[model samples]
Target: MTGWTAEDMPSLTDRTVVVTGANSGLGLEGSEAFARKGATVVMACRSVERGESAAAEIRGAVPDATLDVRECDLGDLANVEAFADGLHEDYDAVDVLCNNAGVMAIPRSETADGFETQFGVNHLGHFALTGHLLDLLRAADGESRIVTQSSGAHEMGEIDFDDLQHERSYGKWDAYGQSKLANLLFAYELQRRLGNHGWDNVISVTCHPGYADTDLQFKGPREMGSTLRTAFMGIANAVFAQSAEQGALPMLYAATADDVIGGEYVGPGGLFDMRGAPEFQQSNEASRDEATAERLWAVSTDLTGVEYDFESA
Candidate 1:
């Protein structure tokens, strides 16, 4: 099916899910749905206060919800490692790992590890987190899924192997785009690696929220927008962008949907794949290029120092 709704998915009861950046926005929406579906949902956030508050809000909505909040800043490599350890300590099994938390356009900032902010938090952090938690995921009783969030902006991105940290010069949008492109590449390569290793049981997918009017843009500087762009975004959000709940549908589908294929890219089925119901969305040429995906995988492996089980494949 091209377009799918969360309601069209099978039961997710007894499943245990971990969602990074679950404090608010799409991550929180996805966590709420999973918790409401009788799954144990962990809100992995950078701020304990925000994470707990989000959990409380979810509990208020679903009084019988099974939800817990944990803190880990993905921008820090050490923190990512600790988060993986924390997940191992907290859960015996993790059925779904939603690498949902991310940053948008912002003034240049370095992660705790001194890498470019966007790449650090969006791609590298998730890379390490996933690598460290492989055992727990493999222990999950049924199909284990990982859904990585990519963006339409990836079409404009090119990975700079020479200067990934932007040591020479950097533009916010270029950095953001590269990180998002890395996301798609990671997901695609992950699926391929898993298949080669015969761990095809673990599904990995990518998706964009399709211009949902979340805090990603609103929380940034005022210069990043103007009266005109603000008004445009407002109208665009209302007309083309989906609600947070709608935006999370693809994630929820990819997480719990039966018969979902590995490496599939899902997003809104309407207009330019920007809004509507969740469906198999298209990736840009840059993201879809097989060679780039492979090279990026090698780069990621080199950077993260963790290799996927793909030798046999």
Candidate 2:
């Protein structure tokens, strides 16, 4: 494909998609793309007012777009569970789940569940949400997919099993890397488990935005009140980053592309995989360790009290 775009997305009529952080940035772009293609989209946000505004903007352009704004803070497991329960109650099945919301290199913090902020919201939050929605995904009439957003920073990540929450020492980038790496590990491990359990219709995949110039890029610096860092990042984003729309192509490809299969990691194909067409890419060796994956799965289940029931797989 010389140029792959959202225009290439297949008709998603009658499908229902849930995109976390759909209130802004790549999530907003992706949600709009899906809605344009005729899918009902659930914009899962941490704030209801912001979510409604985003949905209204989408409706202004696509008047018939089916959009629902739901509040679900990824850093809060209670909110995640409530959001999942409401979704299950309202919809018979979910065709796609895009775990796209995340925080960047912010200062050390903890989620409402007492886990590291980045790890809690980026990895565990989506993990628990997916577990809660497994049945709805399985109920889809045809193929169903889960796309967990990962990142290139994952190359620097090392899951400190002993200090998962960085209890002893904390570096913002270090924590962010670990969470992104965990995203890939979770996605691949979920795929393997699905295959083992013979759940051919349900697939798990992973993707990265590839330096998208979105509001998220500034979250960390803003949160830390670092004007210089924020300004530098803003300039860097202008010079080196792709638009949020372009950055979202990889996830869209992984979500609906006919050639995609379970366990694939899709990202940009341009220089350093930062800004180009979506293509299959390899994650770091650490992210591929089976033992780590297994251990993480067990730890996650215990931490979230939500387990993937592969009994019907």
Candidate 3:
């Protein structure tokens, strides 16, 4: 895997893949790659109209692409449940789930559930979604994968159990980091739980797009009405970041590479992991703390009211 690219991905004909935040950036790139490899991609976005437009663009490129556009607003638990329910009604099994949608460094805000926007949508939303779909993923005919998108920002994160929602105080970057770190914690802990429950057919993996040029970098500035900051970020993206398609290599690799094992983290392989091919990487120590993961899992279940039915395994 020294120089792996999406072209190296194995054929996924007959497979069903779900991608959240598939309207643009890495999500759209990954969805297109999966479609090119003969997989049926379910584009899960917050807006059905935008999703359909993205699907149209994909079909314009990959004429025979099998695609579905569905509404999945991670900021709302009810919306996520409806999305998962629709999937369950339509498909018996899902070959892959890419927890790729997220918000970053925006002005302080709360989700529909009253949880911090970053923590709620980035971590808890995906957490509940995974729980809702675990059974269908396990029912897949072959090995199935759940790829959670994390970030390098996680290194600076510390899970503040006392202020998980940043209720008392809020720092946009801090909240974003915590949520990304939670992604890693959840991914690793899910793999462990799957192992203990004897569910060998499903594996959980984590990946990060190392400093890719995506709309995410500009959203915060735009939201804050800071044209200067937005322009600065645009300059940074142009000068330092890799293309979204190139940045999506790691998650695609984690989802499709035969050698990828459960509980592994994948990211860019270049200097400082900012660009290049996909490769295995290691996260900070806090991200792997089992005790923290367990507590977070319990709190997440309590908050989202979604429980993993591991007993069935």
Candidate 4:
């Protein structure tokens, strides 16, 4: 297809897909689409009530939708580990694992692991979850995928090895950018490692939602107490942001597209990659730095204690 949208998504019969932050926004939209295509979606969210409600709404729309609402708080490593363990006990194999949960720019804070909130939750949390579930992903009957959600903001990011947590100084946007950049780095590095180990069945891909209008935008302004910025965001979202469904197209495409290759980055096709149909896109040079990616991987493994046994695969 020249242009890709949700309508182009292929059938997902008998597929077991896992989506983090699946209660709302891009995650919810993506989960609903997967269910519509016949995949049994596991909705991993922080709140059980919201997750059940989202699952019900999807079931209401698609009567035969197969959905499971599971609790997972990405800000806490313990919770992520427990969630992964539970998935292993219940599911035999996983067809797709979409690391779609994340936090954007907000007041300087830390996760339960004591790392900076954005870096900890956005990058490290997903890293640990993927590592924990690596066996299930590898056990799939056929090709399986790990699609990570990155951002356009990654273009401005720089990873500071000296103070990775931003305890010395913190700029919300900069911290957020670093986390997004880390997402791409992790995706690419994972694909590379998989290739090195001849694990070609598991493809690692990355995507961005562009400027999607969702509750994720409000959190930063709310935490920072920036009334003016909050008002501006409200207006900008109305005027510039794409709907959550539209924003989810890139992720959906990355997760299901037949032509998708490992280490590829997907995003909007329109101007500035803000909004449009899903298409193959480019990430910044910083995101592609091999040395930095290796260093970050080592740090992440140390921080979360979730070692990826690529050699064994």
Judge candidate 1 against the unseen true structure and give its global Cα lDDT, from 0 to 1.
Answer: 0.82
RMSD of 4: 1.0
Give per-residue CA lDDT, model 2, range 155-250, as digits (tens).
999999999999999999999999999999999999999999989999999999898999988999999999999999999999999999999999
Q: Write the per-residue lDDT of candidate 3 for residues 1-313, one digit (tens) a residue.
A: 8878889999999999999999999999999999999999999999999889999999999999999999999999999999999999999999999999999999999999999999999999999999999989999999999999999999999999999999888999999999999999999999999999999999999999999999999999999999999999999999999999999999999999999999999999897999999899999999999999999999999999999999873
Clashing pairs in 1: none
Candidate 2 or 1, higher lDDT? 2
TM-score of 4: 0.98
TM-scores for every predicted model: 0.92, 0.99, 0.99, 0.98
Tell me the tens digit of each residue's lDDT in model 1 across 1-313. Answer: 5556656666678888999989898998988888878888888899999899899899999899888888789888777788788787878988999999899877788898788889989999898888887777777897899899888888888999898988798888899999999999888888877777778557788888887867776544555646776676667667766788888888888787776788889877787777787777678877877888898778777877766544421
Most accurate candidate by lDDT: 3
Instruction: Give me the runs in candidate 3 sitting further than 4 Å from their true place.
Output: none
CA lDDT, candidate 2, residue 234: 94
- Sorting all predicted structures by TM-score, with the top scorer first, yields 3, 2, 4, 1
What are the clashing pairs of model 2? 197-313
lDDT of 4: 0.94
